[model samples]
Target: MAKKPTKDPNYKVIAENRRARFDYAIEDDVECGIVLQGSEVKSLRQGGSNIAESYATVDDGELWLVNGYIAPYEQAKTWGHEERRRRKLLVNRKELAKLWNATQRQGMTLVPLVMYFNHKGLVKLKIGIAKGKKTQDKRATEAKRDWQRQKARLLRDRG
Candidate 1:
């Protein structure tokens, strides 16, 4: 009997921006749709996009995603889209207005967290409205994380 071939795991990652966690204290999060070109969507399905450096901005009452990186697919015959193009976020006018109001406070900014496809195969972006954290604040967060890890280790040893 012939053995069946092993198939590669299927994971269609749209994008992810890791920097949002380290630099900001997130206040609220919103999931919104992404505007995409045909080639851009094709590239996204192939995987490996970066949203870690990307940010969301409200300009002229529209929401824009900046610095998101979606790489070109290797097998595509035609031209792939630019690596780091600003993509418009597809949100309703009222939603954008609300987000705009929420982000207008001092030290508050809109940041993209992760871009992934839903079960229905629609692309979605997780955006957060956050306040920039101070250096001491980041240090304190790190200290707390370390303490938690140590406490977990101690509990595991005892139990």
Candidate 2:
């Protein structure tokens, strides 16, 4: 019997954009701090967030996360945050410059890959600087993955 993987109580993933890797070719990634309201943080702690359709952008020399969703905290009805709101991301000047250059000059995209709480229990967002893939490129990637899976199966059977 196989042993199940242990779960870490402190480290938890609130949301992940699994399609980001499939749709974009990630060139580089950076972890960023997000500005959130009290209610937003409480909602995220309950795992009521989605990063699948969200992205990051550098605007006016500041990094911002766009279209990210944090569900409303029912108890905080009076001070609940908007479900979808633009949130500022914290990054150093040097990293901000790099991301700006990648997007403006190189025409790369800032895709949100994952949103989670680190070991210290602070929220972090991982954004990837990626170039969008053409349809043919996506098909090729799929084929390559399939071949790798088949090869691994064949080796296991032969060994």
Candidate 3:
């Protein structure tokens, strides 16, 4: 068998919105490029960014990331970027149309799932096409998770 490729050392997760999976059901996800200033990139490298409160939107034929937070870079005193400013997301025309249709016609949401550096050291965002979960749905999910944990524990003990 051919040797499996190893994980890329350059790939690193900067921020992840763990709550998104709990609050919404993710049907699909797409990787997107984000436009960032120098200061913002420096801040992300230092690793205090937050994507929990951020979301993606398709507007005027372009995708944008809104409410994303990148901590200010102290060294870049004069040219520091805004911490919560909207950032533009890059995607192809066909993907943009699909995202728009999902949001406008299917009533889905574009939730930011993770921000990470790819193998080539370029930053990327994974945005999910999700639908909001009802309270009962959340409860059922929690119950299922609890059962899974209990079952694992039982298996471990018996083995």
Give the clash count for model 2.
0
TM-score against truth, every candidate: 0.86, 0.92, 0.98
- Considering every candidate listed, which one attains the maximal TM-score? 3
Clashing pairs in 3: none
Worst lDDT 10-window in candidate 1? 6-15
Ranking by lDDT: 3, 2, 1
Off by over 4 Å in 2: 1-8
Q: RMSD for all candidates, in order, please.
A: 6.4, 3.7, 0.8
lDDT per residue (tens digit) for residues 10-82 in model 3: 9999999999999999999999999999988888999979999889999999999999999999999998889
List residue ranges in candidate 3 displaced over 4 A.
none
Clashing pairs in 1: 16-51, 16-52, 17-51, 17-52, 18-52
Choose 1 or 3, whichever is better by TM-score. 3
Which number leads on lDDT? 3
lDDT of each: 0.83, 0.95, 0.96
Ranking by TM-score: 3, 2, 1
